[model samples]
Target: MTVGGDGGPSSPEAGPDLDAVRYLLVGYSADLLVDLDGFLPERSVAVVETPDVIEARGVRGQIGAVRCLAAVLAAPIQDEANAVRLVGLVPRPPRIGAVVPASDYGVVAAATLAAAWGLPGAGPDAAPVFRDKAELRRTAGGAGIAQPEWRLVTGPAEVAAFRAGGDGTCVLKPTNRQASVGVQILPPDADVFTAWALTAGAEEQMFRPGDAGGSRYLAERLLRGPEVSAEVLVRDGRTVFFNTTAKDVQPGRHPVETGHVVSGPVTEEVAAALATGMRALVEATKFGSGVLHGEWIVVDGVPHLVECAARLPGDYIVELIAMAYDWSLLHGFLAVLEGRAADPAPPVARGAAIRYLSAAPGTVDAVDGVEQARAVPGVCDVLVRVAPGDTVEPVTSSWKRPGHVIATAPDAPSAARAAEQARAALTIATHPGAGR
Candidate 1:
């Protein structure tokens, strides 16, 4: 592993002096780190990532200005001890600005390191609550926040009992996994054993073998309603910016998100309920500073908590939020993390939406219409991650989806329509009969 200060000599006895660094970025996202480097070109950044990710992403070559520190860990960084060790690679803690997580797996480590260093971040005790769904449910429930009925299960019989106790249907998911990897919605007559096996065996592709979360699971009574996520920025346990994002999910055993629209309209009552729920969650978690992405199901104008994350949201939602509001969420997130107040969100200037690309499960033969999709009115970007000879699997999770199209317009419906139209303009021809 390579570890050194900025343009300094490497020595085993004398480690790098990180005193000049202002931010310690945890996790690996090449594009995000580069953007952050651009945002604060003058400020020094120290990044902690696995050696494999550093090599695969060419992180050092991409972000020349950012100092790259690699650590070969016995466990994932989400593990608090491993997180501490990863950040400890820096000879000394940087300035008292912030420690930021670039991905879901970095939240706990970032929070823990920030607290230990006396920098602004989610409280050390509260970061794990955001990562673990069961704990989040308990915390939110204790705060009198509404949520669907849920229970932890370790075996098939417990899942069966939970389903039986519910209204003949339930959702089973891993307590700590993200991107819907181990999530499934079972009907009244669904096979409990098969569902349990599938959910238990699921794993995230990003992690190395044996580095994923444990086999903990939760069975919850599935609530029905329009699903939305609240993107919020908080400082000193107070909300400074909040926006409601409308969501679309695949209707099947796995509820993988398909799209999201920022600054979308909601009824007055539902908006109020969402605000109240957000406040309750912030207080319950005792979150100190940074971004909070909370999901909810609005039933009868009441928003029920669906788990939240302390890190920046995935799936280009941050970019969409910036486009819709004519401001930078990244800027606000950095500001709050640096112990400075975030700028109050302005009124929605436009609507921004993203629609993901999907094709039948098979081997891709050809891709077409990408440029045409980009030419569509209001279409800002269209990205197709698959190519000829690539295998396209069933959309069981966010990573399985191939690509997406982003659009902006005067209103939410118009932006959503434009995004869908642009997505329809593209095509990925696949040879059928490849099973998932």
Candidate 2:
């Protein structure tokens, strides 16, 4: 894993800095990977493992305590088993008690693992209400929140009915998935059978079968409007609303979140609607504490709750918010874990945004304009993950992304424009990789 200092290198202290409590950032090292130049210097910390490796790397002592519980890093079954094994090896759970999973899959897996070990964690039962699209819609509906008309279909019969007599158009999506993978827009008089069949197959690949549940998919009526997400942090059974962000969904689809502009210039009315919808979610999910990532669509004047996750927003959304707001949410999570109160200081900066450098599906042969993109003013920095010889796949989900450029500016629009300019300057060429 990579590490950096915020200001200057810390003076080599006597032994490892074990005075402060330690945190185990589970998941791909990417989440904690960024802005460490700014995040470090505050204290001394250590990382468990790298993203490429599946097994956990043992870290002796760097902080006050030790524990392994990162959701994103534990996605593959092997990683999950390793995380559990690490916890078991510790003799006891870390004194600094809390597990803040930043990914949807992480939250559920972390919760399940923590609970299995009798630690205070969000379990599958509490997690599904937010992680599963079908479950979120159903839970919101039961809580009297307005949801897009939805149907849980298995085979031909259910798909036929939803296609025959539902709204004008319906969106078919996998139940246990995120970032709009295997999502299809259903058309009227559509080849309902064929489309449904394709959607089902996508779900199987999207989720590890026999691991969670079975054959569960959502046929949801497509809602139209400006999209927004309320990224709120819950603490001690109370709601601590963070900055709201504007989302750009895949052009004709609803679930596919292509990119996001933090703190969009939205109307007061829209803000109120977003806040109201989020409040409803906080209640519906019974989310006493932790992150509540909720998305909404403002239709005509009514704001419908699209879906929610009991975790932090991905693609460094929380990082941008932390930078803009001058708060360390990752640290706040730790504080909450230590039963400390949060300081309510709003964001000081005006804008922060991330534009993903997406590419067409193919094996990557070359990438160009990196130097030019880096030279753009207001373009903070570019960290390209895919190399010249790496294969690049279609932008189906957040995982298939080429890389992302995070930019900050005086306002949202300027930041967005700079990001787009940076994106436009780059190009990627793909060819068949060695194996596949």
What overall lDDT goes with each candidate model? 0.80, 0.61
Tens-place lDDT digits, model 1, residues 259-300: 999875788788778888989888888888989999999887
Ten-residue region with minimum lDDT total, candidate 1: 67-76
Q: Residue 226 lDDT in model 1? A: 93
TM per candidate comes to 0.91, 0.76
Alpha-carbon deviation at 264 in model 1, angstroms:
2.1
TM-score of 1: 0.91
Which structure among the candidates has the greatest TM-score?
1
Cα error, candidate 1, residue 186 (Å): 1.2
Model 1: number of clashes?
A: 0
Residue-level lDDT of model 2, residues 272-361, one tens digit each, is 877777777767666655667787887886778877877767767877777567776666655553356666657557677778887766
Residue pairs clashing, model 1: none
